[model samples]
Target chain A: MALVEIKNVRKNYGTLEVLKGVSLDVEKGEIVTIIGRSGSGKSTLLRCINALETINSGEILLEGQSVSAKMDGLRQMRQKVGIVFQAFNLFPHMTIEKNVTLAPILTGKTDKQGARKLALSVLERVGLADKLKAYPEQLSGGQQQRVAIARCLAMSPHLMLFDEVTSALDPELVGEVLKVMEEMAAQGMTMVLVTHEMNFARNVATKLVFMHQGRVWEQGDPKTLFANPQTPELKSFIGHHAG
Target chain B: MRQFSFSDLLFLATALEWTFLMAAIALAFGVPVGLALALARTSGSAVLRTVATALIELIQGIPLLGLLMFFYFGIPVLVGKDVPTVVAVGAAYTIYTAVFLGDIWRGGIQAVRQAQWEAGACLGLSWLQQFVHIIAPQAFRIALPATVGFLVQLIKNTSLASVVGLVELARAGQMISAGTFQPLLVYTLVAAIYFTICFPLTTWSRTLEARLNGAR
Candidate 1:
């Protein structure tokens, strides 16, 4: 069974539909990069997978269990799925160490001493081990994004979702975040990302998904799909990025 | 006409205690109740939100004097028994403080970015946990200056308790002025006392706001 299965998911914000009958499957250890226009619902689809935004109809399953289940079931599913947002939403009042350790300690996944150790290890993984005492605002955009990733890593999630995580960074700083994500992919983390980094999508992504007008217009092996455009939307999208 | 004496000033100083006591009573009861109202106003349930909104609006719409009069005069008639001045005045101020503080804190909590809640939720933290650990501290910082500002207003408004026959600072000032017929001198001294109490609070509020801004 696939690690994550999304079946004919439909979502609407009032009368305007965002995701229309979108379906996909992500196997374990696969890096699936979703790329599309701004309103193509790429980010919305990623949000739906984690149940952050509820679908109007259809099902999202993780490891054969429903992701839309309420209360404990939903929370239990979320514990295994880590999502880093575009905004790098670190808790401003907390220090870097507290931000990384809070969830693990609160959920009883680790005690205080163990959580400290876990925080150290995860911060090191993101190349931010020395920033333990710094607050979110004290760091630059890229540094803050790295700390956010470290926070998610502390949970030891099985599947990680990246939603335009580098979109808000300065061009100079974008490379560092992408490098961290690349390392995670190299470690065989199952990741589904919605991003605009065409080169990263072309090289690192095992599977490339092209979405247009709230539908997955085309998807396949990244190299094959990029080399041969199956649809005009994909062709134009690639052309736009190539410029 | 007699002059304003030192003993009269001592009486005013003693009466300041009543003013403090009334303000304390209001806050003691108001802080917790106001927090509940703020949570209810921001809660997911429409019913809770509406109820909280209605209660806050009701208390806020009426003048503080009207509330004091209603509690002092209306309650005795409603219950067919005389209500003590302190009980009526204290009750009035408590409800008054609760609603005002509730609205202030509700704005603070709402001002926090929605992304903060989502961040916590994605980490598998429960809603209460999200609020306690993620949202509350941020909201408290946003609300602190306004909260302190409201406290200053509450202290000044305590002078209205004199209408219910309580000899607080303002009432004591009135008594001294009536006896000495030195209204200007007596009122000036009263105003100075009020300035003394409220000035420090306003200063503290500004300092707190600056410190929080600097930290960010």
Candidate 2:
């Protein structure tokens, strides 16, 4: 069975339907990249997988269990899922270590010492071990995103979601974060990335899904999808946008 | 009529207790309830949002004096029991603070990026966890400046308790004036006391706001 199975998921915001009957399967340890125009439900699909944007219809199964708002559902699903956002939503009031350790100590019921140990290990993995005392605001954008990723990694989740993780960074800072993500991918971390970085998708993704107007326009291996001219939409998309 | 006395200073010093007490109580009750109202105001449930909106508007629309009267007179009639003047005053101010604080906090919470909500949920955090761990902390940073500002307002509004026959700073000043027939000096002294208490807080609030916004 796939690690994640999203079945006919639909999402609507009032009168507008952002995602209509979207479905996909992600195997364990496979990196899937979603590419689409703005408002094409790419980000929305990523959000739905994490149960951030509640589906108007259909179900998302993680390891053969539905993700719901119930306590048990949260306890089970959350243990397996982690997410890094575009804006690096670190807790401003907390230091980097605290931001990473809060969940494990609180929800995972890990002792403070154990959680701190795990936090430091992940911080080191993200090459930010020295920044254990720094606050989010004190760090550069790329460093902040790395800390955010470290925070998620402290959870030791089976699957990680990245939503335009480098979009908010300066051009100079983008490479640093993408490098960190590349390292995670090389280490066999399962990821569903909604990104605009064409090169990252082309190189890292095992499968690429293109979304257009709330539907999956196409899906294939990155090399085949990005290189071969199959559909007018794909050709036009790759042609018009250099990235 | 008379030079500043130890007795007068002692009286003012003692009255500071009431000011702090009322302000502290108002905030302690106001903040959490106000936050809940703020959440309700922005909730997805139309009915809950409408009810919260109506309550906030109603509280904002009426004068605090009118609220004092309603609490003072209306409570007695409604319950067939007389409420103490101080309790009525505190209750009125708490209600008033809740409305304004709710509005202030709603703005604070709304200032947080939408992606933060998505990010929190994606971590498998429940709605309550999102508020406590993610949204609330950021909103609190946003709410802090205005909360301090509201504290100053609460301290000043304690003067209104005099109308209900509670002997707060303004009431004490009025009593001194009636005895000495020295409205100018007595009220001037009263204003000075108020200024002394409020100026530091006002400056702190402004500095906090600047520092927070600047940090962002």
Candidate 3:
């Protein structure tokens, strides 16, 4: 069984349908990049996988178990699935160490000493060991995003979801964040990215899925899909974004 | 008009004690109730939010005087018993303060970002955990200044208790003035006393609010 599977997911806001029977599969340790025009439901799809947004109909399975089980089951599933957002949503009132350690203490039930040790370890991994005492407001945008990634890492999730993680950063700051993500990929973290960074997707993703009008217009190995996209929607999307 | 007497001054001091006591009691009861009302207004359940909002609006809509009258006059008939004047007056102000403080606190909680809620949920935290760990810390920072401001209002509002013959600050002044027939001198001194209590708090609240936002 695939590590994560979405089977006919549907979502609507009032009369307007946002996701129309969207389905996909992600293999273990595979990097899947989802690309689409704004409002094509890429972000919503990522949110649903994390149960941030409930799907109108259909199911998501993780490790062969339905993801919509009891709240505890869902929380247990989330323990394995980490998500990062475009905005670095670090807790402003907390120090970076506190921000990173909060989930471990609250959900993982790790003691203060253990949680602090884990927070420092992840901060070190993210090249932010020196910033453990700093608050989010005191850091640069790039640094805050790195802390956000570290916050997810402290959970020790096997599957990571990144939703437009660098779109909110200054152009000069984007490379630093991408570099951190590249390092995660090299270390074999299974990642699902919703992004507009074409080159990163082309170079990093094992597979690229282009979504248009709330469904996958086309998907294949990056070499095949970008080289010879079969659909006009995919062609237009790639054409407009080609470097 | 007789010269300002030492006894009259002592009476004003006694009245000041009553005012502080009322403010302290209102705060002790108001903070927790206001926090609960704020939670209700922002709860996931629409019915709870609606009911909380309606309760707040209902309390705010009725004049504070009417609420005082209800406590003073209506409760005896409803409960088939009499309530002490001080207890009845405190009850009315407690309800009034809860609604106003609750409305202020709702704004504070809302000042936190929507993303904070998502972050808390992603951690698999129960609603109580989310509030205690994430929402409460942030909300307190947002609420501190406004809370102090409301406290000053509460101190000033305590003067209204004199109408119910509570022998608090304003009532003490009225009693002194009746004996001396020196309303001008007596009320001016009373106004000065109220200012002495409230002016520093107003300044402190403004300063703290500035400092908080400046850091933000």
Candidate 4:
């Protein structure tokens, strides 16, 4: 069974249909990169998989169990999946260590000492060991995003979702956040990312998904799609993003 | 006919004790009521939200003096049961504090970006957990100045309890005036006393605001 599966999921925001009919599968250790125009529903789909947005219809399954909107199922689903947002969204009042350790300690997955140890190691992984005591306001945008990533990594999530993580960073800072993501992918994290960084997508993703008008326009190995012209929408989308 | 005596000033101190005691009771009980009202006003259920909103609005619309009269003079007539003037007056102030403080804290909670709530939800924290852990602390920081400002108002408003014949500061001054026949001197001293109590709180509120902003 695939690690994650979406079968004809549909979502609408009032009169506007954000996802018409979306379906995809993520196998274990697959780095899937979703790319599209701003309104093409990439971020929406990622949110739906994480149960942040309830689907209007159809099914999303993780490890052969359908993702139920019921509290217990959703909690179990979330424990396996971690999501990072465009805004760093770190709790402003908390030190980086507290922000990193809160959910784990509150969820009773670990005690204060164990959560702190996990927080230290994950902060170290993000190259932010020196900033454990620093508040979010004291950090640079890139550093904050990395801490956001480390906060998720501390959960030991089986799957990671990045929603336009670097789009909010300054041009100079974007590289640092992407580098942490690249390292995660390199270490074989099953990552499903909604991103606009074309070169990173082309070079890193094992499978590439192009969304257009709330549908998957095309998808294939990154080498095949980047080198060959398939659909006009994708060709033009790639044209606009070409290096 | 007479001069204000040091003994008379000690009597004023006794009045100040009543003032502090009544205001303390109002504030102590007001905080939890305010918290509940604020939560209800912000809740997802339409009924809870509407009921809380209506209660807060209705209470805020009534004058504190009017409320004091009704709770003190009106209730016994309506209920055909006698009630203590001090208890009724203090209770009115407590309800008044809750309504005003609840409205202020609602704004503070809202000052936090909606994105923070989404971030908390996405993190798998329960809704209550999110408020306790992420939302409430941030809201309290935003709320401290307004809370202290309201507290100063509550302290001053306690002076109104004198209408129901509770000899708080102002009433104490009035007693001294009848004896001393020095109305101007007595009222000025009363105003000065009120200022002493309120001014420090206003300054403390400012300090807290500055410190919290710096931390942010």
Best candidate (score: TM-score) = 4
- lDDT tens readout by residue for model 1, B1-216: 678888997999899999999999999999999999999999989999999999999989999999999999999999999988888899999999999999999999999999999999999999999999999989999999889999999999999999878999999999999999998999999999999999999998888888877765
Ten contiguous residues minimizing lDDT sum, candidate 2 chain A: A67-76
True contacts kept of 2: 0.42
Better of 1 and 3 by lDDT: 1
Compose the digit string of candidate 2's lDDT tens values, residues B93-177.
8888889999998888898887676566666566788788888878878788777887788889988877877777888888777
Q: Judged by DockQ, which candidate is best?
A: 1
lDDT tens digits, residues A1-243, model 4?
A: 999999998899998998988989999999999999999999999988878888988899888888756646577578778899999899999999999999888878889879878998999999999998899999999999999999888778999999999999899999989889999999999999999999888999999999998998899898899888599999999999997
Interface RMSD of 4: 1.3
Candidate 1, residue B113: lDDT: 96
Candidate 4: list runs displaced more than 4 Å. none
Residue B15, model 1: lDDT of 97
- Residue-wise C-alpha lDDT for candidate 2, range A142-183, written one tens digit per residue: 999999999889788899999999999999999989999999
- Model 2 global lDDT (CA atoms, 0 to 1): 0.84
| Collision count for each candidate, in order | 0, 0, 0, 0
RMSD of each: 1.7, 3.2, 2.0, 1.4
lDDT of each: 0.94, 0.84, 0.87, 0.90
Q: Candidate order by lDDT, highest to lowest?
A: 1, 4, 3, 2
The top-ranked prediction according to lDDT is: 1
DockQ of each: 0.70, 0.40, 0.56, 0.63
